[model samples]
Target: MTSTENEAHRRDGADPGHRHLFHVPPADGGRYPESAYLAGNSLGLQPRATRTELLADLDAWSRLGVEGHLEAERPWLPYHGLLTAPAARLVGARPSETVVMNSLTVNLHLLMVSFYRPAGERTRIVIEDTAFPSDSYAVRSQARFHGLDPDTTVVRLRPRDGEENLRTEDVTAFLAAEGHTVALVLLGGVNYLTGELLDIPAITAAGRAAGAVVGWDLAHAAGNVPLSLHDWDVDFAAWCSYKYLNSGPGALAGVFVHERHHGDTGLPRFEGWWSTAADTRFEMTPVSRPPATVEAWQISNPPIFAMGPVRTSLELFDAVGMPALRDRSLRLTGYLERLLDEVTADRPLTVVTPRDPARRGCQLSVRIGTGNANELTKRLRHEHGVIADAREPDIVRFAPVPLYSTYHDCWRVADALAATVEATS
Candidate 1:
């Protein structure tokens, strides 16, 4: 190995991540046995404990049948409660303020039902221009549901001309000036494509000051960065578990509703059997007596099996803690950025993510200048076994997940790019 490659291995030796706890996929190419998996922003590797815990739940179902609801080791009836504290801890929320249920978009919609009160002059919903497509769709649909023209009711904030990422000052300025017309401000905590970490607390404070409800879609930020939604005074937030959370695909999502919003009977929400207080659930009352907690927003009983992976994953977060993870993330991503700087210096690629570690997470997105991103990613995977994510025409994302990625993984990415892309003359 070259001196640089040897250095990477040495760094891994000193700061060995929790790689042994998870299964790394075998490489389809390259000399290494394991693929340099750097796609945690898209999907995380499966934790070894997931299968063992999942099967135990399955056995409970097979053995105890209906009785498993009460008799299973992790009792299905109150199983979701097992996740609440850990999920709450993960996002710096109170147990009453957090609930693990539904998918990310579903939770956003449910929270919107109570928070997105567009009326008269304030009938606009504000979102980032480059928001994930799902968020864009959800907000537009919400505007339509309110009998407002989506084109008119939805206001998308864009970065300044020639800028790749939106500035915090720009976003706050817009909210200050036009926020009177904006009934809701929903933004991603960490942008999906560019990997920019927005100033959540500042933005949330700005929106609330402007008389707009502020909620966050933290799909990319939840486990990737340190967040204190409750302390940030965010009105509501939701995040998926399949990515940085290390849960299986389509795993259940977690939602946070600020304590200030709880017990506000004036607020509107759609309710179901599960939305009511658990103590009164079996009373079979015609009218739902929903609790004052975030659970009131829960529309239905969560699928037990779906909750299993999320629970298992949250437990891991609790064990390791975000502070430690974030420290390692900074080190790991910084190393990757330095390596990428060297590779992209002579290639037709540019790291689009912010240079400031505080402005982003573990993810680093490279904008391809001359090739199809999808095709390039496929080549990287099949030829070099550098598993990364591609976003259509130009952006390729590489997330050196703090939980499993190594310094060598980052080196491999740089090394592979150097070998694949031709340097400019």
Candidate 2:
């Protein structure tokens, strides 16, 4: 093996991660036995424990039927509760401030229903220009829902002319200046396209200072990095489980409503039977008594099966805390960045994700300079067994998930790119 390759193996030996706990896909090409599964930022590998736990939940359904709600091993009726504390801990929030419910965007909309009150001249919603299409659509639709022209009501923040990542100062400055026009400041905690970790606390503070309720779409942030949403004083936040959280695709999402907002009856929330307090849920009362907890945002009974994977995944995260994961992530991604720097030196590629560790997460997004990103990713995958994701035009994202990803996995990515894309210099 080359010195660099040997270095990767040496590092793996020294700092091996929890790869054995998850299923790594077999390589479709290359001599390596396992594919360098670096796409966890897109969809995390299924945990070994998830299948077993999920099956147990299914068995309860098969054997007990409706009785499973009360008698199942995990108990379906309050099954969602099992996830609340762990999910809350993962994001550094109190159990009362957090709850896992519907999908990510659905949770965002539900939070917006309570938080996105555009009154008087403050009718704008601020989001990043490269905000995930779903967030862009959701916010724009929210503007339309309020009888406002989305074009005028939704402001998309962009990086300065020559920059790839948005600066924290720029965002705070914008809020300081135009924040009066903004009713809500909803941004991705991590920019999906650039892999940039925004200044969540600073931005939230700025938005709130400007009289706008601040929320976050943490689909790319949760489990990928350490968060203190409650401590950050964020008004609300929502995250999907399918990505770094290692839950299955379209998994149920978690939402955080600050404890301060818990019992505000004046806050508009679309309620249902499940939104009522758990004790009074089955009392069949004519009026709903929603708890002061974030669970009050829940609309329907959770799908027991859907909650299983997330619960199983959260247990794993709880076992291996975010601080430890983030430490490993910084080391793992820093290693990948060094490799990319060497490879991209001679190739038509540029790392668009911020170089500073504090400015980004486990993901490093590369801007392809000469070829179609999809085609390049196909070559990287089918030819080298390096699985990474690509944005339509030029960006390709590689996330060396700290849990299952190895130093060798990162080595394979650099090696794949070196062989596939000829050196331009």
Residues 156-215, model 1: lDDT tens digits = 999999989999999999999998999999999999999999999999999999999999
> What number of clashing residue pairs does each candidate have, in the order they appear?
0, 0
Model 1 TM-score is: 0.98
Off by over 4 Å in 1: 1-3, 423-425
Over 4 Å off, model 2: 1-3, 423-425
- Each model's lDDT comes to 0.93, 0.93
Q: Which 10 consecutive residues of model 2 have the lowest summed lDDT?
A: 416-425
| Residues 1-425 of candidate 2: C-alpha lDDT, one tens digit per residue | 14388899999999999999999999988888899998999999999999889899889889999999999888989888999999999999999999999999999889999999999999999999999999999999999999999999999999999999899999999999998888999999999999999999999999999999999999999999899999999999999999999999999999999999999989999999899999988889989899998999998999999999999999999998898999999999999999999888878899999999999999999988885899889988888889999998988999999999999999999888888778322
Model 2: residue 343 alpha-carbon error in angstroms: 0.6
Q: Weakest 10 consecutive residues, lDDT, candidate 1?
A: 416-425
